[model samples]
Target chain A: MNRSSQHPLRELAERTRHAGAVLRTRSLETRARVLYEALWALADKKAPSGRHAREALARTTGLSPEMIDWSLAALPIEQARLLMFAERAEDRVPVDLAGVVLAGNVFVAAIEPITAALLLGAPIVVKASSRDDAMPRLFRAAIREQDPELAEALAVVTFPGGDEDKERALFSRAESVVGYGSDHALSELATRLAPGARFFAHGHGVGVAFVVPPDHDADVTTITDALAIDVCAYDQRGCMSPHVVFVEPTEHVSARDFAIQLARAMDRLGQRVPRGPLPPKVASQQLQWRAIGEAQGGLFEGDGFAVALSSGFRLSPGYRNVVVVECTRDRFASAIDSVSRFVRVLAQNGQWVTAPADCRCCAMGEMQRPRFGETRDGIPLHVAFLKET
Target chain B: MSEEHKRRASALIARLAPPHAIPREDAWRARDAHLEALRAFQKAQIPVYGRLSERFGALPVDVLRHARATVHEASEDIRVFLTSGTTQGARGAHPFRDLSLYDQAAKAAAAYALFPDGSLDLCVLAPSEEERPESSLSYMLARFGEWFGERVTIAFREGKLDLAALSGALERAQATGRPLALLGTSFAFVHAEDAFAERGVTFALPDKSRVMQTGGFKGRSREFTPPEMRSLISSRYDVPASFVVSEYGMTELSSQMYELTLRHALNGDRAPIDATRRFFVPDWVRVTAVDPERLQPVAPGEVGILRIEDGANVDSVAALQTADFARVVDGELELLGRDPDAVPRGCSLAIDEVLSAGDGAT
Candidate 1:
C-alpha cells in the first residue's frame, strides 16, 4: 500500500510508448533478428556483460550457475521456434505497447516473454519482480548488443506492487497487458488494467506427469529417468515442473513401485545436477511435507527430492519435492479434474484414454523443453502479443 | 463443572504445578510418565490417534500427522475451536469436550508463568468472546478477566482497534495508580503504537504495569522482531522490558508458555532480562525442538520444529507438533520465528490475508 513517487514510472512508460510506435513499424524479420542476437549475447559467457548478467541472475534468483546456463541455452531455441510459428500466422498486428509483469519463481522466465514481445514487434514495458530485478536488466543488456534501437523499445521498471496510481499509468498507456503470477495476483492485476486493453493472464499453475509404465518391466527405469528430469527442471519452481506423477497401474508394476524407482532416479539426477541451496522457509515446508507423508506411511525421500504416495494431490513448495499418486483408469480423470484449475502442463509417458482439455500434454522429460511454439495453459505464446487486424 | 471434568482438571494440575526447582532428570521422568498416560488416553478416546498409533509409532509427532482430523465423537458436548489457518486455508479444529479443564489449565499456566503472585487490571487488545466465540485467545483472556474479578476492557471491536478506549484505559490506570496488564497479539500492539503516534499520544502506566503480547505477525504487517516489540512496549507503557512478557500459545493447545521477563522482574533480578533468551513452560506442558525430517529431538541449542506435549489438553490429543522452529536452551524455549516455508498456522491468519491480497499465484 506504500506508493512510491509515480513520476519515474509514468515518465518511463511514456518513453516506452514512444519507443513502441517506432518498433511497430519494423518488419517481423528484423524483430526476429533482434531476438536471435539477444539469445547469442546471453550465451556469450566470455563477454563482461554476459558474465555480469549471469552472476546477477544467480545471486538475485538463487538459481545455481548450471541451471542459469541451461535456461540461457534453451532461450534461443524457444525464441526461434516461436518466431517461425508467428511467421505462419496471417492477420497479426503487434500491439503498440505491451506491458509484461514477470514472475521471479524461475531465473529465465523473463526471457520467454521478452523474446515473444520482440518477435511480435511490440515494444514492451516490463515490471520486473522484486526477487529478480536483474533478469529484465540482463535482457535489456542482451537486446542492446543485438540492436540498440530494439533496446530503446524495452523499459524495465521496479517498484513494490499495489501502487495503483503507478500501475494505472502504465496500464492506461499500453495497448495490452500480460501478467504471470498466482490466480489471485492475476485477477487483482486484471482489475487494475484500463478498459479495452487486451489482458493475458498466466496464473500460477502446476504440472503433473502421468506414467503408463511400459508393458515390459525393464523400461521402468527409462520412464523414471525422464520423469526425474522434469521434476528437477527449475527445481520444480516453474509451472511446468511436475508436482505429482500419476502412475497408471501396469501388469508388471504398481504405482508405488514406480514411485520408488522415480525417487531413485531423482536421487541420481540430484547428485549430477545438484539443487540450489533452499531458503530456510522452503526447506522447512519440504521437510514438513515429507515428514507428514512419512508419518502417514507412504513417503520415499532421496538427497534432494521426495516422492510420496498420497490420496489427494498437493502442490509442492518446489525444491524437487514431488508427490506420486496411483490412479486407476476409472479414477484418473476425476483425480486430474480435481486439480484442473492449477494444471498447466501434463507430461505423460504414453497416451491416456482421456486427458484434460485445457492442459498441454507432452512426452516425459519434455515438460521443461516443450517443442517450440507449444501453447501454454491452452494459449499460443507465438500469437499472444498480436492483435488481429 | 461435570464430575469427570473436575477430576481430570485436578489430576492435570497436580501433575503440572510442581516448582521449577525440580531436578532436570526428575522433571523429565515425570513428564515422560504423564505423556505416556496422555498418549494412552488419546489412543483410547480419539479414533484418529488410535489409527495413528497402529500405523506409525506412538510418537507425539507421528500422532499429530492428523492434526486436522475431527477426532472427537459426536456424542461429546464439545466446543470446536478452528485454527486461523495462517498457512493453508484448511483450518485445524481442536475440540474440547470439557471447558472446565481448559479453563483450569489456562488459569494455572497463567498463574505460574505470567501473574505468579496476584492478578492485575486486565486490558485486552482483542475482541471479547461474544464478538469472536471461536477464538481461543479471546476465550482465554475472558477467563483471565474472570479470575482477576475485573471488568475486562476489550480494546478491539468489529475488527478495528479502539485506540481512544485503550488510551483512555492507560490514562485511567495512571490516574488511579493501579497496576495494569495488557494482553494481545504483537500486531495489535503495533497498531496501537501507530494510532498513538498519529494522535501524538503517549502514556506511562503505574509502576507494576506489564504486558503479554502473544502471536507473531503472520505476514499481515511488517514484522516487529521480539526485541523491537519489547522496546516499543517498554517505551510506550513506561514499563521496563523485563515487565513485558511474550506468551507463546496457539488454538491447538489448552496450555501456554510465557517468557520469564515478568517473573524475573518480580524476583528483583535487576540485571537486564533478555526476554528472548528463554521462555517458561508450565509444568503441564513440555516443549521439544525436533529435527523436522526425523521428528526426533534435536541437540540442545539447535533449531528445529517445535513439538508440544501439553497435559492440559485432556479432551483431545495431548501431543502436538507445530511448523514453528525454535531452540531449547536449558529446558526452556528460545522463541524462533515460524519455519519460512512452513504452512502458516495460528490465529493471525496473516498469510491467508496477504495471499488473498494478491501475494499468491493461482
Candidate 2:
C-alpha cells in the first residue's frame, strides 16, 4: 500500500488500519520495525546546502553513526528490561490508534517503545521537538527517502516550537496519546484529547545517586564510573536524569564537595552535551526570581548550597555548569520541590533506594511515588502501552 | 573630604580586595598544591566540596567557595562562556562568589542602593521565590528581605508578574505611608507601566517613594530612551524625575552603575551632587569605559563597552563584558545601546542568530 500515484500518508493510514485490523494478538517487535521504516522514508531528504539534516540530528541527539554502531554493536538485546520486562504487558483497547506521537529525549532511549510498536505493526505520527534527540528525526527522513515502503508506514514532522493545535489534532485521531513531559502539562493535554483517549504519560523525575564512601576493598573506579554516568548522560536530562543527588557523606565524601564535584562533572561534559535554549521569558523570570530570593533566605550566586539549579547545559543566554545552592543533604529534596517527589533515590551504603533514613512523613512526601527515573516531561509511547498490555 | 580623598578611598578599598575572586582559575589547582587542602577542608566542615578527592585532585578551599569567588578573578577562565546563541549577547558570565562575599555584596549593594538610610518597607514586582534560580536579582532581593524583612509583596502565577499583587502592594503602600520602593527589571516596569496607569492608580508613593529599576530595555523592541522612561515615571507619579533611580548592574559584577536625576535637588549644579546619586564605582567595583573590542579604556565621553573588575566575585569568574554599550560622561556612566551581532562581541555573535540557535536547541 505504498503511495505510488496516490497520497502515501493516506496509503500508510489505510495500511496501518489494515495491519492493526486485529485488536489483539499483535507482536511488539513487528510493530516497532514497521514504524521505524516508515519514519526513515518520511525524512526530509532535500534540505538546503550545509543544512545537512543528518548532521543536525547527530549534533542534537548525540547519536552519530558512531554512537548508534556503538549501541548496536556493544550492547546486546538487553533493553534495560523495563517494568513489563521479557514480554509485553497486556492492556485492552477497542480500536487501532489512528496516529502515534513521539517525544524527544536521548534518541536511542526514546525510540525503544517505537521499536516495540513497529513489532506490533502500528503506524506512528511523530511530533518531535528541536530540544534533544535530533538523530531519530533525521533518520526518519533518511529511512523515508531511502525506502518508500517504510516511509508509508511512518509520518515524521518536526516543529521548531510545539504547537498545541497540532498536538491536539494528533491526539484527536490517536485512540491513545503517548506523551513525555511534566505531569501538569500532560494531564492538561489529555483533557484536550478525544473525550476517552488513552494517555500514557511520563511525568518529571529526579534521578538519584548515592554518595557511598568507597570502601578500601570496593572498586572506587566502578563507583565513580557508575556515578559519573548518572551525571554525564544527556547532561542529565532523562526523567531518570539525576537532579538532586544524595551523597551519603563520610570521611571520604562531603555533600558540599560532592555537589561541587557533580557540578564539575557536568562542566566537563558541557562540550560533549547539548546546552539548549532557555526562553527569554525564562531568563527574565530567573532574574526576577533571583531578585526575590530574599523571601527565601537564599542567594543566587554560585554558592552551590541549598538552591536548586539548572544543569551545566542550560538555555540561559550564558549558561553555566552551576550547582547554585549548597544545601545540606537534609534539604536536598525540598530544594528541587518543583520537580515534585519523583525519581529521587538516596545513595547510602552504595545502594539505590527511595527510602530516606531521616524523612519521617511517609518516608515519601505528600505526593505519590512519581516516575522516579522518568526524563523529560509527561509523554507516553504506544508500544509501552502495548508492553504493559 | 575633598574629591581627591574620596577617589583615593574608593581606589584603596578596591585594591585591598584580593583582585576580587575567580572560581574557574581555581579549577587548575586540582593538579596543584591546594587540591589536598580543599579536599581535606570540605571533607571536614565544608560538607558540599569534599567529594572531589577521588577522581580529581583536591584544592585549598571548598570548590563552591572557589567556584563562586576565587576563580571569577581569573581573566582566562574558559568555562565562563558568553552566550553564543544571540540577543543582547555579550561576554556576560555569572561570576561566582563565596557564600560570604555573595552575602556581603548582596547586603552592601541592596543596603547601599535601597536602604542607604535605614530599613523600610521593601517590595519587588520582579520574579520572586517562584522564579528562576541563580539570578542576582533573586539573590539581592532575598538578602535584602532577610537583612530587613521578608516584605517582597508580589505573587507569581503561570510564570508571569501578578498584576493583582502589584496593584495590591501599591494600594497597601498608599494606605500606609511607610516609604516603599518598587524593585524589578526595566522590562517589567515598561511592560506593566501602562497597565498600572490605566487603572487610574499611580504607584502608591510612601514618604521617600522611589522606583529603583534594574536592567535596561536592552533587547526590547519598543524603544524608550532613559529620559522618556524618566518622564514616564515623572508624569505617572507626581514625583520629579530625580526621584526615579535607574540601577545598572549585572550578575557578573558585584558593583552597580546608577543614574539619578538632579532635577529635584535644591543644590543643582552649584553644589556637588551627592555621591549617592552620582555614577561611579563602589569600593568593591571598578568601571572602565573600554573600546568594547580591545578591552582598552576609551577617552572620557566616548561611548564604549563598560568593562568592570569587581573583587566581590571571588568565588566565580571575574571580569565581565556587559551587553550594554555605554559611555562615561563627566565620570558618570551613560548607557548607549546593546551591542549588535559581532565577533569579539561577548560571544561575538548577533542576538538574532543566537536566539534562532536557541530556538533550535530548545
Highest-scoring model, lDDT: 1
Q: How far is candidate 2 from the true structure (C-alpha RMSD, Å)?
A: 14.4
Lowest lDDT 10-residue stretch of candidate 1 chain B: B342-351
lDDT of 2 by residue, A294-346 (tens): 22223223321112232211222122222233344465545434333343333
Give TM-scores for every candidate, taking all chains together and pairing residue i with residue i: 0.74, 0.48
What is the DockQ for all candidates, taken in turn? 0.15, 0.04
| Cα lDDT over the full model 2 | 0.44
lDDT of 2 by residue, B1-362 (tens): 12232243233333323433544233223212232232233344322223322311222111221233232245644333222223422223344423455555555554544555556666676766445444566666666667865366754445567788877777777888776667777777776677877776676476576677776654445657667776787666555556677787765555555554432342254433333345544445555566532346789877655655444443432344443556666546666555322211111112243233332211
Task: State in Å the error of residue B150, model 1.
Answer: 5.5
Cα displacement (angstroms), candidate 1, residue B62, comes to 8.7
Model 2, position B216: C-alpha lDDT score: 60
The per-residue C-alpha lDDT of model 2 at residue A386 equals 42
